[model samples]
Target: MKVVKVNLAKNVAKVDIGGTQQWIRLDIVNEVPKIGDYVIVHAGFAIYRLDEKEAQETLSLFEEMLRHEAPLH
Candidate 1:
């Protein structure tokens, strides 16, 4: 996910998740993320920042897995 904006007072950030926007807490990350940074979000929190290579790899993996999965009715 890419960070779009941050709310320091709330300790949360607004991020783009595959084009969709969502808010995630920043408390879990080791370092604060600036806008345009890529992060790994889990359970409503930004767990860690991802380097460019790792981000691409992770995104590709997710796309591949999702493509083969059965869709919900």
Candidate 2:
């Protein structure tokens, strides 16, 4: 997931997950993330931050899975 925005007041961050945007709570994360940072979100919360390489790798894997599992048209 990519951090798009952060709501410090609410302790929630808006993230882009596989092109979809959603708000995730930051209470579970040890480190605060800024916009453009990649994070690992689970159960409506960010668990950890990902480096650029890891982020790209994860995104690629997701894209691959989507491409293979998408419904045939």
Candidate 3:
């Protein structure tokens, strides 16, 4: 799945995946994520949020696949 956008408010986040948006309630027991972040969404919930580097890498791979780029080591 691809994370199209992230909207964070207070402690919760609304992650938009593909063309669908899902509301993820953050646990008050943990830290809150910032806006424009990428999260690992499952079952209408965001389990974890990826860092900027990882998010960039993921999007890069998606773009590469769309362009049919060869895998690099």
C-alpha RMSD for every candidate: 1.7, 2.4, 6.4
lDDT of every model, 2 decimals:
0.90, 0.91, 0.63
Please list the residue runs of candidate 2 whose C-alpha ends up more than 4 Å from where it truly belongs after superposition: 68-73
Point out the higher-scoring one by TM-score: 2 or 3.
Answer: 2
User: All candidates' TM-scores?
Assistant: 0.82, 0.79, 0.52
Candidate 1: where are CA atoms >4 Å away? 71-73
Q: Candidate 1: TM-score?
A: 0.82
Error of 1 at 67 (Å): 2.2
lDDT digits (tens) for residues 1-73 of candidate 3: 3344444544456666566776676663134556666776566566777877887788788888889876687
Looking at model 1, report the run of 10 residues with the lowest lDDT sum: 49-58
Candidate 3 Cα lDDT to native: 0.63
Clashing residue pairs in candidate 1 (N, C-alpha, C atoms within 3 angstroms) = none
User: In candidate 2, what are the lDDT values of residues 2-73, reduced to their tens digit?
Assistant: 999999999999999658999999998969999999999889999998887989999899889988895778
Pairs in clash, predicted candidate 3: none
lDDT of 2: 0.91
lDDT of 1 by residue, 1-73 (tens): 9889999999999999768999999998977988988899899999999876888899999999999999798
